[model samples]
Each structure stands twice: as C-alpha cells, then as structure tokens.
Target: MAQIATAAPGWNRFVGVSRPIAAAILGLLALLMAWGATSDVGRDHVRVATSSSPHFDGLVGDHALYARIAQRVAAGESYYTTAAAEHRAGDYPLRPFVAVRLPTLAHIVAALGEKKAQLILLLIGGAAISAWYRRLRTEPDLPRAAAIGALFVAANLTQLAAREWIFIHEVAAGVLIALALALYRPARPWAAMAIVAAAVAIRETVLPVAMLFGLFALIDRDWRAAAGWLAIGLGFAAGLAAHVAALAAVTTPADAASQGWNGQGGWIAYLSFVQASSLLRFFAGWVGALLVPLALLGWAAWRSRLGLAALSIQLGYAMLLMMFARPANFYWAMLVTPTLFIGLVFAPAALAELARSLRGENAPNRATAV
Candidate 1:
C-alpha cells in the first residue's frame, strides 16, 4: 500500500503518496499504458469500419432504425408500439427490455424534429464546453496550461456532434453527462442533479453516474446533494421498471433475445471501446491507447474532489466495459467520453510533478477540493 503524502503546516491538502511509492506506481502504470497502447487486443474485433468522417456507412444502420422509430412516434404512434414494430422489422433484439432504448430521446426528436433536436444537442455540447472551461479555470490545483488544453480538447469534440448522429442516444446523453459534471458546484447542486436525471431519462447506461454522484456526496458528507442524487437514482429505478414492464407487455416469445453481454473482453475491449468512441477514434490505435493512461495519471495528480470524482467515474466505466461489453458495444464509451480527453490537458504537469516528487521536492498548487 502507498503512504499518503503529508501536507505542510498551513496546507489542508495532500496527494497520492510519498515519492518512492509514487515512483513505483507511476512506473507500473507507465508499463501498463505502453502495453495497452501497443497491444491489439480487440482491434480485430471492432465491427464498425473507420473513415475520415466520424459517421460512416457502418454506423448508419442504428441511426436509420432510430430515425424510423422517431418518425412513427411523431406520427402519433405509442413509443412502445412503434419501438416493438421497428425492432421486429429490423430483426433487432427485444428480449431484454433494455435492448429497446428508453423512449426519451426519440420523443424529443419527435417533438422537436430532427434538425431542431440536433440544434439543441449542439447547444448542450457548447454549454458543456463553456462550463468545463470555467470549472477547470477555477480549480486551484490545476495548472493554467492544463485547463486550456482540456478546454481545447472539449471544444474539438463538439465537431464530432454531427447532425446525423443526433438520433443516437449516446450522443445526447454523453453531452448531458458532460454538462452535468461541469455544472456541479458544491453550493448549488440542483442544476447538476437535474441534468443527471435528464441523462438517465435518455440512456439507462447513465444510471451509474447518478449512483456515483450519490456516493461522492456521501463521502463528502454533503447530505443535500446526496439526497438529491439518491432521489434521481430511485426515480430512474422506477422509470426503468416501468420501461421494462412496458417492453414485456409488447414482447412475445418470438422476439429476439440478446445473445448476451458477457464479453469479458478485458483491458483490450475497454481500451478499444474508448478508442472507437471518443476523439481518439481519429488517431492511430497505439497513439490513442497511450493517451488513455496519461489521462488517468493527470486526473490522479489533480487530487481534488472533482479530480477524484472524475477518475472514479472513468475507472468504474472502464471496469464495466472490460467485464461485460463486446467489441460491437464500443459505443458504450460515449457514456464517459464527454470529459475523457480533458485529462490529457493535465498529463504534462502531472509528469513534471512526478519528477519533482522523485527528486525529493514537494509539489505545489495542491488543493483540498474543487
């Protein structure tokens, strides 16, 4: 186990560990990152073909299906009824109700029309970027350069929000998650909590974020925030239950059941999943994979409440993808991709700090909380 670093007399904050332990952990992490960067674990297994354009013919099948469902919903069809029909026609699985996406995004598309819905999503993405810039700028421990890099990466990701991708549930939910994470303020948690609830309504996969928020709130002994997150979780549970029941009502024995999500693809799958979903998708496999660990290291160096929370959430999802997601399920990375590259901004400073620690020097600019 690593020993926690001690703070100075007037300092209230400390970081991961003493220099030696930090060196050992950093070394191991470096080796792991290199191995993952070079390894082609799930490279051969990724189903979608890549292209210069983020949206390619390979990804259009699901988008087309979603579009059809939205059209029906807009034409006065019940969401459950339209979704079941679409699934059966497309030979998509409906056995597990979760396979049928929550009707939230479809409803939004139906109500707003695709063009307007896409506009709203882009606006949300823009807001998330602005919010992130503000959050990073204000973080006491984060270096100025790191904050700018994070903002740049975030702004770049906005370009990936192609209008055609509007129908994809993950795109909207991912932006919303980004917004929620950036919007969170210790003094005013209401907006953040509400945004998380909205994300849950869009994608069931986002439920873990709500739980994570609740856990972090409790750890910080912020009762009101914890209660709000708990309420969102409970509400999501009830909504999910109803969604499941609704699916069952329309489902028949003949409906196709999912083969299963037990991929156990391990680190390869997790890294590959992330590579395919985020801006990393635009880079070569090895180059992108290497960034994964650097980003984590950056977050580790942060040692603030927001940093810890961000790190925990990313790792939690990484574990899930490693254990459960198949190669085709790489898109699930969208759940965490909104803030994924933000860590890259801090990687250089983090590396410098590690060097300082190794030289028996105390790192400065540490903070207790965001």
Candidate 2:
C-alpha cells in the first residue's frame, strides 16, 4: 500500500493514458522559451535596422541576393537565370519550382520595381494592422486575450516595416494569417477562408494552419467551415503537386552547385546555428527568437485555436529546419516571422494559464475550505 502511494501520480493508467505526453509538451515549451529569450532577437533587430549604406544599396547577403533576383525579373529574365546567378557559388538548383522559393514576391517586385514595391507593401501592411486594430472598437464580447493577438501581429509587422524587411511572402502570409484569425467569425466565414487560402499561396508552410482550422471547425461542429477549409487545403496541395511536377520537368543545370541543396541536414545543422561562427544566423531575422515560444506557447493555449495552428506551423518549420534549414536556407523562416512574434507576444498569458492547468492536474488535492 505504501509502495502504491509512493508510485508516481498517473502511473495507474491502462488505456488512452500516458504521462509522457504531458512531459513532452512541457519539455518542448521550456526549450522554446529558453532559446527564444537567449537567441538575441532584439540584438538582431537593432543590427539589421542600423546597417549602413551597403544594405541600402542592396549589397549585403541574402537581402542583396533577393534584391538582385528581383532586379533580374524586372529586367525580363527567367526565374532560372535570376536564381541561378546567386546560387552558382552554392549547389542550389536553378529549376523553376526549386524549393528555394516561389515567385510571388519576385513577380510583384518586377512589376512595381523594388523601391515602389517596398512602398506598396508597407501600405498594405499598415492597412492590415489598422483593420485588426479597428476591431477593438467593434467587437464587444471579445476577450482582451484576442486583442493581444491583434496588437502582437500589428507590432511585429510595424517593426518589419521600420526595419525594411519588406515584401517577403512570409511576412505577407503572416499578415494574412493574423487577419484571418482576427476576422474569423461565423457571420463572415468567406473572408477568413479567402485570407487563409491566400496565405497558403504565399507560403505553403501555412497550409497546415489552414488544415488545423478545419479540424477546429470540426470540433466546434461547424461542418461548413470544416468543409471550406478542407477544400482549401486540397486546392493548396494540388498546386504544390503541380509545382513539384514542373520542377521535375525542368532539369537542374549541369554546372549548378549541389553541395547540400536538396533537403539536407540533421542534428548537426540544427545545433550549428547556436555557434557564434555558424553561417546560419537564425537570429539574423528580427523575430527568430520569438519563433520558438510562439510555437510552443500557442500550441499549449487551448482557448486559442489559431494559436494552436501557429504552433503547428512552428513545429513543422522546426522539423524542416532540423533537416533542410541550412545557413543559406534561414530565409525560409523569414516567411513565418510575423506569426512567430505575434505568438510570442501572447505567450506569457497562455503560459500562465497552461501552468495553472498542469498544476491542477498534477497536485494532490485536499478538501480545504475555499
């Protein structure tokens, strides 16, 4: 009997029960919080924003690479030629549908020119932030927690604009994701659906978030919403499949570098980003640190369905980063930074609530007078 009493709590479970599940969630959350704090997001933000004329003239690293890519498109070059030039030093392929990226931003930049495109994106981002902010005046029953999400997203984007991380599709996707969540309502489901679908086009990483919305809708027994999201996911998947087929049809150049471009890396590459000299400076982005907590905290916050979806996107990206997110590929995370910081902004409250629930589940309760 004493041994039984001494046995760990929750050890008597038979089916549909396990202590490891809770432990895993807690562990991941802790790691994310710790890393997000120490990864120097603030430092990186300052550095990027303070860089001299080199950055202004588009003579830096990936910023320059992307700028040059846009210039080539503006000059009427094909995707292959533009991407090929920067990647010649690396083994990256010059294929049409290279996982390196999609052509959404390039197309926009080509049409508008980089400076003009920058101004346009800044305006659109401002409008999105304003739209969500205006909801505070209108949404009466809305909880303060919801407003946290709105402010978080708006602030992150504003920082991006201030720092000139303009027009990256991921930033656009993040804006759309926030807008979708803020405006997601039973009265006007179509608007939310359209925004989320547009995010899928901007960055496929957002597709799972769309699917998670479907799952949440199913749980809420909103079959129409579930069906709409399911259809969106299907269409997004079909588009990706077509892109892959096109990539296969256009063979990589014989002279193209091929060091580790095709989905390569493991624990070594994952941990390498932590080293001072590591080429893949994850914190180079203004909000890289926030990605960790945003993913973890949002996942644990049961009250926020979109938070959970943001967590899913973060986890998916984490796995991809572990495998394929090399130093050169850090730009991948750029697409998701908006959502990451937004999630990070609301993490403290979500974490406190999560802590209370976990303590309630684990602590031995006594019948004390309340």
Candidate 3:
C-alpha cells in the first residue's frame, strides 16, 4: 500500500466518490486515450489544430481573412457586402449560411471601434473575475480559493488583450459565457440570462450554453430562470431566421459550400483545440494538453450546481468538438475557454484526495452544493 496524501481541508470536496474510484476513472481515461491514439482517427485529432501550416498564408488562413473583413467593416462598408466579397475573394465558403459570421459583431466593432470594443471585452473579463470571486468566496468548502478563482478567470482572458486576436467572435462569446456562469445566482438569474442573450447575439455557438442554462433551471424547478432561458432561445431563433433571410439576399448559388464539419477527430482533437483556445497554447503541446484533463478533474471534484453546470458544458463542447468539428475548427475550444481552465486551480486537491483514497485513508470529505 502507498502512503496517503493529505488534501487541504477547505478544498477537499467529495468528487461524488471515494478517492480509489476517482483514481480508477482517471486511469481508465488514460488507457482510453492511449488506445485511441493507436488509430488514424485518433491521430487525426491532433493534426488539424497542431499542424505547422502557416496561419496567414493569404490563400487559406483565417486570421488575415478576419482582419481584412474587420478593417473593411470599420471603414464603413456594409457587413454583408464586405463579408461576401471577402469570403469569395479568400476562397472561404458561403453556402452553409453559418459560414458567414453574424453582422452583430461587425456592426459593433464598426460603431465602437476595435480599441473600444477590446476595452469592453476587457471589462467583461473583469466582470467574470469579480463574479467568480464573489460566488466562490461564499463557499465555505473552498476557503482561500476565491482569489485563485479570480486569477483563473483573469488567466483565461489574458489572451484577449492581444489586439491581433480581437476580431475572433469566439473570444468575446467565450468570455461572456464565463461571466454568465459566474454571475448565475439561483435567487437572481436575470443578470446571467441577459449576458447570455448578448453572447448569443455575438456568436451562435453560445446557443448551446443558453440551452444548458435552461435545462439546469428546469431541473432545479426554478421556473423564472427556466422561462428566462427559454425566452433567450426563442429570441435567438428569431434572430437566426432574420439572419438566414439576410444571407439569402447576399448569397448566390455559385457561392462555395463549406467542406463540412464532421471531423470525428477524436479526443486528441478536442484536447488540441482546448490547448489552442486558452493560455495553454503558449505551453509545450503535450504539457498544455495535460491541463485539459486536470481542469476537467477539478470541475468533477466540486459537487455544487455550478460545478455540475460547468462540467456539463465543458464535456458537451468536448463531445461536439470530437465528433463534429473540422480540423480548422480548433478555435471552437474558445466556446468553453472562459470557464474551462479555471478548474485547474482545484486539480491538485483533487489528485491529492484521490491518492489518499487509493491509500485507504478516510478523510472527512463532505459534499457541498455551494
């Protein structure tokens, strides 16, 4: 038998089981990943996002393409005109309708200017930090961890300050999603709902998150919250309908169709995308990717509504990315970035607790809903 590792009292929450069970689950995860990598499908998962291909190759890269559109829109061109022209000229697809970004972000960037828009994004980041701190500070089981929570929020958003990355729609949407998660208080859910609505307006990808919120509210019997979430979904549907109409007016039969998103890229694809989307991208590939699972473990360790919600959202996105995202869609990880890495802060305690359980030590780990 191995010696038991001691877990910090305040951070030790039952991860729904004793440590040995958690260890076994983690072990199984490792084995599955190893087995998955032995196949071409699994190997392909790490390829799209991590390929050494040039990003600004002019003919095929997205960064320069988005920057060009942002510039033209800022110069007073109609979004549809600029978008259609740019996509056609850049050889980007237009047939999927969704391939053309919604006009909300372009119009906002044009009206506010990129710098101001970036500042607003920064403010959203700050709000996420503040909201997370306030929410976690109230948790008696996570003492001294509130500041770390704020730090993680800040860390996840730090990349937003790069002006070069400002135009990526997922950047703003992801941060807003994080803030919404942090702002959610069962007693008063309006603020979070409003923020989610705004995020969905910016990026359609956020729709899934809004639906998750509605599901949680319904499960809790929080009728007001559920209705609010439902309203956001319906409003988004109307907006999308209008968007489709607008697209039809601009799109032509000759416009190119997307190559499609069914990558079936596997877990490596999901983790690679996660690495690209967060600060983890700055680290060595495998090291950065390792944090993805640890962060997931941290989320799993918490027993509260917030923990479960965050874990579910992250997992749902993981499955979507693994099953449907194209290689170039690695940036889709941004859909969960604002809230994903924050779980890393809790991972050490989780591992320690798991170790203790493996050593057959009984710790006074209680489950908390806060």
Candidate 4:
C-alpha cells in the first residue's frame, strides 16, 4: 500500500508537468479544425473555377483583382495608374478596394502569387493567437485565466471568419485593432494607433472602435491617448477624402452608383444588413454551442465600468452597421467578437462559483461572486 501511494505521487507529478503540453496540443487541434474549414472554402473556390465561394465571393473577387493588379505590375504597368483605373472601372466596393490598395502587401502578393498570399494569411491567423496570448501575459491579474481565453478566442468562429476571408483586409485589420486595444493601457499608444490606422484602411467600420477608445481615454483624462485617437480619426477621414477624390477623377457619378455608392442612405442600409448577417452567422452557424455560455459570461462582465463601455461600443457599432450598410453580412461584426469574448472570459470563474455554491460550501460568498 505504501509503495502504491508512492507511485501515485509520481503519477500526479507527471500529470501536472504534462498539463501545459496537453493544453498546447488541444490548442493546435483547434487551430487545425479552423484551418480545415478555411481550406474547405478555398478548395470550393477552386472547384467553381473562381477564387471564392458564394458566401464570400466578394473576398474571392478582391483576391482575383489583386492578382490581376500584381500581374499588371509584373508586366511593367504602373500600379497606381493601372490598378486605380481598373478599380474606377470595376464594380468593386469601396472597402475591398481600399484594402487592396495596401501597396506593400499587394506587391508581395503580386510577386508570390495567390497561393502564397493565402499561406501568409494563415500565418497571420496564428500571429493573432500569439498576440492574444501576449496580451493575457501582460495582465498580471489575469495570467492564469489567459490560456483558456486565448484558446477560446483562437478557436472561436470569429477567428475562422478571419481565415476563410483571407482575401479581405478585415482579417489582418481586426487583429491589429485587437492588439492595439490590448496594448492601450500599457502605454503603447503608438502601437495602438498603427493598428487603428491599418483597420481604418481595411474598413471604415473601425472608426467606431477608435472612437470608443478615444472616449475611454478622455474619461480617464489621458490627453495623449485621446490625442492619438483623434489623429487616427483624422487620418481615416483624410484617406476617405483621397479615395473619393481619386474616384471622382477617374469615374463618372453614374459609375460611383454602380460601385455601391447610391447615396449615403443605401450605404447605411447595407451596413445594417451586414451587421444582422454577422450576428446570425456567429450564433446560428459557427460556434453555435458555445454562444450561450459565452454570452452569459459577457453579460456578467458588463457589470464593470470598462466592461459596460466595451459592450456599449459593440452595440453602437451594430446599430451603426444597421443604419448605414445594406446587404449586411456576418463577418462585418467581426471586430465586436473580441470585445464580446473578453467579457465572456469571466464565465469559467462564474461556473466554478456556481458549482461551489451547489455543493453547499461558502454558498453565500460564491453566490455574491457570481
């Protein structure tokens, strides 16, 4: 009996030592599942003799356009003139066109080809997971909880959206946005601004998130942070103006309408559609089983002031989408998912408290914690 007890201690030590390895393995498995889903969609695009599926044809088309731009550039055509002229002539939406305008990434894709671009995007997805993990490490109060949070965020349906829609700039933009927000309190304003700029360049919808961050900075009386956010906003506005000017120089007013600028009203309506679609796709299609528990935790987290602010911003963004965009797609709400998941990080603790209360040990204290 003594020998058996001694052996059990060694077994326990092995299990403890292997915990991290197990977690890492699980995390990798989750990522593999996400990658499989993205590859499935990519393969479908190939099967259809297109670069995208029906659900995300916009992204595919954007990639194809980028490829064409790359090809033209490789053939000694001027990028700004040829690509800009083609963009003015095409029916591409403003957001996607702006994303494709990333000169550096565009050149790389042009040099390497679409398959290589897809591989790079996959790496970016992994980088996002690493960023989240880093963010958790910085939060001393949340260190132990960070692993679970990272896993959840990394494997969530939203991350899948990032992978599947690789052609769109939003995936990279979203990661930047999250990293910026995560670093904001660590006196990393410049880093944060860089991310905000990238997100704005990808999609104008990031403006709301920037505004929310600015509001938080203002409330905290952090003038530099507030100023940084203001600069980001101004930069976005300037970019938008430049895009509009370029469009005007190359295309007629009728062409603008065909390109999805049927006045601000139509834009508003389309944004709303995108927001609604995002919610349905998240809840009903991807991550369906985990939604309820996470949502409950998010609600609980909103009791904190910062948490409430985040929730409010998320809701406001959703409303903005409803008001301004038409043909709303689910992925448009991708930015809101991280904030939602951050709030939901408290859910596991809540569950533990509930379990403790049910066992009739320190029930009152545990209930209060919940």
Best by TM-score: 1
Reference-based lDDT, each prediction: 0.74, 0.54, 0.75, 0.49
State the lDDT of candidate 1 residue by residue for 1-370, as single tens digits: 0111222212112232479876886797788788887788446646752222233333456776788789899999999998998777777789877789999999999999978898888888888888888887666544344446456447445634576578778878888888888877666888989998999999988888888878878887999899898888888889989998998899999899987889898877787887777766777778766878877776665666677777888888889998888776777888787787777766655565566667788666543322
Cα misplacement distance, residue 90 of candidate 1 (Å): 1.7
Instruction: Encode model 3's per-residue lDDT on 143-224: one tens digit a residue.
Output: 5544466776787788789875667788888888888898877678898899999999999988988898888889889998
List the candidates' TM-scores in order.
Answer: 0.87, 0.63, 0.86, 0.60
Return the number of clashes found in candidate 3.
0
Poorly placed runs, candidate 2 (over 4 Å)? 1-57, 80-91, 131-149, 162-164, 214-295, 302-304, 343-370
- Name the 10 consecutive residues with the lowest summed lDDT in model 4: 5-14
- C-alpha-based local distance difference test score of model 1: 0.74
Highest-lDDT candidate? 3
Give me the displacement of residue 145 in model 1, in angstroms. 2.1
lDDT string for model 4 (1-370, tens) is 1221122111111122233443543354345335433332211111111322232324454545555666677677766665665554454433334423544445555677667766765665566567667765444333244345556556542443443354445555566565555555524567666777777776676787778778878887889888988988888778777765654454444433323422232222322233232333333223432342344344343233334455566557546544433332334545655445654555444433334434444422111110
Candidate 4: what lDDT? 0.49
Go through the candidates in order and give the C-alpha RMSD of each one to the true structure.
Answer: 5.1, 9.1, 4.5, 11.9
Off by over 4 Å in 4: 1-63, 70-124, 137-143, 157-164, 186-188, 256-293, 296-310, 323-325, 348-370
